[model samples]
Target: MLLCFALSRCAVSPTGDKLYITNLYEDKLLTLARDGTLLATFKDPALDGPYGLYVTPAGQVLVCERLSFSKLQMDSEDRSKLATLATRERDGVRYPMSVCYSSTTTSIIVGQWVNDNILVFRVE
Candidate 1:
């Protein structure tokens, strides 16, 4: 038997002409053209088993690791490791399943898998 894989999360490009998908098992962010052709991939070692991805208005990509409990920046052209934010007091419930930023980009909304609630935070 063979197993087929598919996209787990998707983010619309800034121009809305492309789509970015995170492949969990592959640990890569695949860029697909509007017509579904493979365009490019923004590779990052930090993307190991990445589950959730958040794109800022400034075009910054944040990758959330479900097993590592770390958040990494995806700006590395060569996929270098960035700062690893450890789990805090607020993350006691479970690993983060999803994340989002406010319009101003001064806050973050985290959705945990175990809690099943959205946690809001102010960016300092």
Candidate 2:
């Protein structure tokens, strides 16, 4: 799908039908149908420099905010102020540049870009 704004990150819904795209420049999350129709826009909890995103089995959205443009560390302790933050789990690990739930493995594999390794977490 052609994004009016550069798509910094995107995550397919668990149903594999919808998509949530993060527009870094616009600081907005655009929800789109499978056919690329704009469904809704969310504000307030605006994402900053969002890099990676994923949808959980329970249908919750997860966004990885890359602090300082490319750094993986948390920008702040509060997390909300940090440039790199996970919107879903409070205790979610850091530097999750990529994530995927594998049915075969039954685990959530998190790709740490800078770390150059995949962290596998069992998903019940």
lDDT of each: 0.62, 0.57
Error of 1 at 110 (Å): 1.2
Please, what are the lDDT tens digits per residue for candidate 2 over residues 30-62?
A: 677889887776543545656666666666565
Among all candidates shown, the one with the greatest TM-score: 1
lDDT digits (tens) for residues 17-114 of candidate 1: 66767777777776678898877776565456667777767665555566433443443244344555535454552567787778775877778776
Q: Roughly what TM-score does model 1 have, to 2 decimal places?
A: 0.67
Which model scores highest in lDDT? Answer: 1
**Per-prediction TM-score:** 0.67, 0.56
Model 2 ranges with Cα > 4 A deviation: 1-5, 14-17, 44-46, 56-59, 67-94
Position 13, candidate 1: lDDT:
57
